[model samples]
Target: MTGDGPGVTLAESGEFAVIDRLVAGRRQPPWVPLGPGDDAAVIACPDGRTVVSTDMLVEDRHFRLDWSSPHDVGRKAIAQNAADIEAMGGRATAFVVGFAAPGHTITAHAVDLADGMWHEADLMGAGIVGGDLVSGPQWVVSVTALGDLGGRTPVRRNGARPGDVVALIGDLGRSHAGYELWRNGIEQFDELRRRHLVPHPPYGQGEVAARTGATSMTDVSDGLLADLGHIASASEVSVDVSLDLLAADLDAVAAAGAVVNADVRQWVLGGGEDHALVATFPTDPPPGWRRIGRVLDHPGSQPRVTVDRVPWHGTAGWESFRVD
Candidate 1:
């Protein structure tokens, strides 16, 4: 798309000028001793270690310009990366972004994208520390999230035991439902459609689960079964998710499913990008977490994830190289 009115294009304003506009008038959190405008950023790691994760989003593949605004795309990029840190039982403190777009793109769109990143970062009291901007064939957003563990041990995916309770904190299937709605060109279910554009991960709940003695944890960025399979494989355990426990989630998307002529169960089980935190706990999960399943011994059996003790035969989750 071409620029209009007084808003300049990236090619017109040049890279440095555009970067200045993106960083101006933004406040960084106190933990971020130094923010943008430097060769690198300085963050405080009081616990002597830092949690880091990175994710990249490509235009039209991860998102669509027609389906999502630049701001929404920015938020999605930061949210997904931040969720990874949270899954490690830490709180995100800072983020560094790498943004690339065509020279013909509007500068205001880039500013809007930065605004969305800041908006989500502020939700967890994190700061946008530093980043780079460049010209590319399409919009590409890459974010690196830095987190603090607050003296708690990092919760890994291999710690789950046979008796651990599988629990989750955040909604499931909404983003997938939204994607279907958007794909079908249905304008209804505005909330689901919006959720597909921007995910609302339980930000501080990761540290809460860690404090509650969670054995293992991961964010449901790829479908529930696919992500749970990660925990199962790592812990060398079999995970059986109960459909009875997921009735509410199924019900939540039933209407949208009908509108799109899709299966709500598949959405809840195999759909991804919701970014919900799923964990296995030895004791009762944190207050907001919902119990969905349990871990089992994997003696002589392959590490796998099942629903109600049955193997699921559907699209497991997103794969990077899959050709549809």
Candidate 2:
């Protein structure tokens, strides 16, 4: 996809030029004492404890060039890493990136990716402090995010107690619906298609949940049931998700479901990549959070997650090792 016509390839621009293009004209947040053009960036953690998380996205496996633009891929990469920090009840402060792509790729695309990263980072008042660029056969975006807890306790999956209120903030199943539409070559549902490309993670709700006394917290990177299963197992408690509580989420995707002739429940339950926050609260959840389920004591030795008290046999989440 490389040619002349006002665009230079990475091979033509050279590695240094490509890196310069990515780092140019970008501003850093106050938390970053030093940004690019140095050995490494120095970041400040306000609460003295740093929350760190990292994620990697591969071309074709995690996204398709035909389906997502470089900008969309960049946003997805940064957003997912940010969600990891949010799941730990922290707010992202600084980000370091490592990007690799074919030498034939256009340099402008790499710049676009950086712009997208900066755009997403700026949403939560964070910044891209530093990153590296390299040559590879296919595009790979890796990000390491650092966060600050603001003196709140770091919430974990094992802290969900029986009788805690299980709640969700952000969205569910929209990404799966978008994936279905894209995979089937459907042209309708523009919103769902866009959601598949760029997820909308709840920006500050992690700290809000923490401040409100969340017992357990996690981002729904996999299927809802699969992620909740983590909480259930870690906390050794059964989780019962009420369908009546999820009616709004179900209705939100009902039209897309009918068009694809697929059950929306599976999309909401089994689909992943929405990056929504789900947590168990000891009391009432804060504003904008939806009450979806409740934590319960395990009847036996094993703890599990159920939908309306019934086992879900469909796909529960994304399995990276499974061959599609």
Candidate 3:
């Protein structure tokens, strides 16, 4: 479909045609009994329980077109939502996306977005079952991810107890380090720059922790302190994080901090969007996780997280209403 000129617009292609392009060559996982083209998608939950989570990414607030390609934005929308299921010790099985953009937006860009979403979903043996498209003021992507627990009880945030060890798997603060590098226009840190645009969450470690008897688990979407605080509050426990245990994580971004004259500790402790899984284990953590702290009985009813036994006075994490 062509518009008045050479470069075709979504307005010219119309809704059904553009959607056809988005789902044209895509393949669905076997669990998807009914994929796109129907009024609804049918996903099989063999374990008899479904793990579900949803997230939204708005233009400019969550991402900048100048900074992220449409493909990058698509990967991010699916990744963040899938991370939520991982936090609950389940594997993502399928996703449904609702995307909105101006009618003038290029149809090819929308197709690229779908391609990026498919690429990330394929990493975890998941599928893009269904979604919707609409014209709006700006780009917005809303994703709902469904997962399977494989008959294991979901590891909750309230099961931690005194003497449990705190552990984490996957990179921490790398995305924030990339954000700093991208904002300051310093192009030396190529990996960091890419991380800011598209995060790489530990894909399958959630089930590993669950199998290893994780008492409580969560993905680090917020800063380490803020996210750990959720577990502490739920479990009525106090947590102490040993910075000495985080030397490798710190060293990973210390050089970037120096280049920007920023505090590396804040990036690691207060930064967010690493999507790394953190959990409490009664014994030694599984092979992929590193012990970073310990859970203790709360001194008072109010639970808290500390770095070296002291409260963090710096920035804690990303506040949704205050994204700037």
Give the candidate number with the greatest lDDT: 1
- Candidate with better lDDT, 1 vs 2: 1
For residue 215, model 3's alpha carbon misses the true position, in angstroms, by 0.6
Tens digits of lDDT, candidate 2, 231-306: 9999999999998898888999999999999999999988899999999998999999999999999976689999
Write model 3 residue lDDT over 65-134, tens digit each, in one string: 8899989999988998888899999999999999999988887788778989999999999999999999
Q: Give the total clashing residue pairs for model 3.
A: 0
Deviation in Å, model 1, residue 121 alpha carbon: 0.5
Worst 10 residues of 3 by lDDT: 1-10
Q: Can you list the residue pairs that collide in candidate 3?
A: none
Name the runs in model 1 displaced over 4 angstroms: 1-5
Pick by lDDT: 2 or 3, better one: 2
Runs of candidate 3 with Cα error greater than 4 angstroms are 2-6
Per-residue lDDT of candidate 1, residues 60-177 (tens digit): 8999999999999989999999999999999999999998899989888898899999999989999999999999999999999999999999999999999899999999999999
Model 1 worst lDDT run, 10 consecutive residues:
1-10
**Clashing pairs in model 2, backbone N/Cα/C closer than 3 A:** 223-317
